[model samples]
Target: MNPGRPATGGSTTTAVLGALAGAVLLVMVLVVAFPDWFAPYPPERTDLRAVLEGPSAAHPLGTDQLGRDVLSRLVDGARLSVLIAAAATAVGVLGGALIGLLSAAAGTRVDSLLMRAVDVLLAFPELLLALLVVAVLGSGAVNTALAIGIAAIPNYARLVRGQALVVLRSDYVEAARMLGVAPARYLVRHVLPNVSGPVVVLASIGTGTALITASGLSLFGLGPRPPQADWGAMVADGKDFLQLAWWVSVTPGAAIVLVVVVMTLVGRGLQMRVLR
Candidate 1:
């Protein structure tokens, strides 16, 4: 019944979401910065005495079929997952943004041709495209990251092109052109900056998707090989023992969910702040 209560409620929700996102980020950082400290046992080490054990003081999240520590593997997996996501997102954003700029600057014929190409890429399902690339390139962390980056480029290209076109028509760009600014200078100094805001937000959101995709590829035996401890790979390895040791699968799965959820929340907040 309070007249001003809606604003209060919205602020509270944002604050809570922000806290959740911060905690997730901190956990990821810890996993990367102090992996050995967080993981009591080596991720690849097998402990025959504790094979397939449930959660216990000696192994907080239990042991896997190979008797490797579940918690250790999950912690190590975070580092690999985040690394691949960041690398793929960077490649997509940089390559796509540049292509989008070129297409926009070159006018109707170029724009149409580039957009059509984007459409072709977009026509295929993202996962399918990634799988195709992995199949061709062969599976490994680097190849998986490259494939995800390539799969994501068309989306960023389209987004940046649309934004660049809008900016191209703006008064600043026209004034720069009239003042005889070089095309490269105009784009770098004026057009690119304005369009980059949305590109950045999109890139942040894309990170979570990239991580999920890379992990999925790895799970399917098309990503990093054994002992690397990627989250998807962990889940894939534990599937056969699901009934015997749920912790092996559940721990890594939960970690993936938690990280992706927090990233999504952060991306939404950034979009609201920047794109609004």
Candidate 2:
């Protein structure tokens, strides 16, 4: 085989995977945007007589302990979950990018100082950091999202700084600098554009993590509160009847797993495509 054959094969694989991921993501978006359309029953509607019923044509995923349609709840949960995740990711992306740009544009000493601070933030586990932030800020979906995004900032900062450093050192960038290009102009036109691809790919993966973290917060009763169809809360509520009605918890858990897996595939595909 030719020496370059492996790279070509890898590229082909990434292309196929990316296409598949895109398709799945499209479906997920549709579900999230118009959950009522996909959900057969109102997510919060309850039937005392149908409580904890197993799967049937009327309720494919079964009824929860409260007789709420498991499938409908899961579908409804996606709307809130994805919105939180996307918002958190956006916060991380914007905040981290700005920090990274400041570090990259500044001199080496400033970069070192900024990065060390970022490193300190990264030292804590993201979930723990988010918890602390949430504790200080108090509960609710917006607060939870803000907390998650704050914790995620260090990761994005590191990624963007690394990518920016490389772009800054490129021959063209150096030539532009020497040719009297304004710092702001080059940083915007060249560095920002170059770092964006990696930032976007990281955001794709980060959204999945953010989603899980948001769910976890909700599980702890820190997000969205009761009566809302939250995946994590669904799992929490179902745990009491786990022995008798396992489907209650399992259905939402499975949805979380599937979504996380799909996002991961999409992110990985984006990474490979960017590297190529």
Among these predictions, the greatest TM-score belongs to 1
Looking at model 2, report the run of 10 residues with the lowest lDDT sum: 2-11
69-148: candidate 2 lDDT, tens digit per residue: 99999999888888888999999998999889989889889999999999999999888888999999998778888999
Q: Each model's RMSD to truth, in Å?
A: 1.3, 2.3
| CA-lDDT, candidates in order | 0.88, 0.89
Model 1 agreement with the true structure over 100-175: per-residue lDDT tens digits: 9999999889889989999999999778999998889988889888889999999999999999999999998999
| Model 1 ranges with Cα > 4 A deviation | 2-6
The TM-scores of all predictions, comma-separated, are: 0.96, 0.92
Show the colliding residue pairs in model 1: none
Best by lDDT: 2
lDDT of 1 at 45: 90
Model 1: lDDT equals 0.88
State the weakest 10-residue window (summed lDDT) of model 1.
2-11
TM-score of 1: 0.96
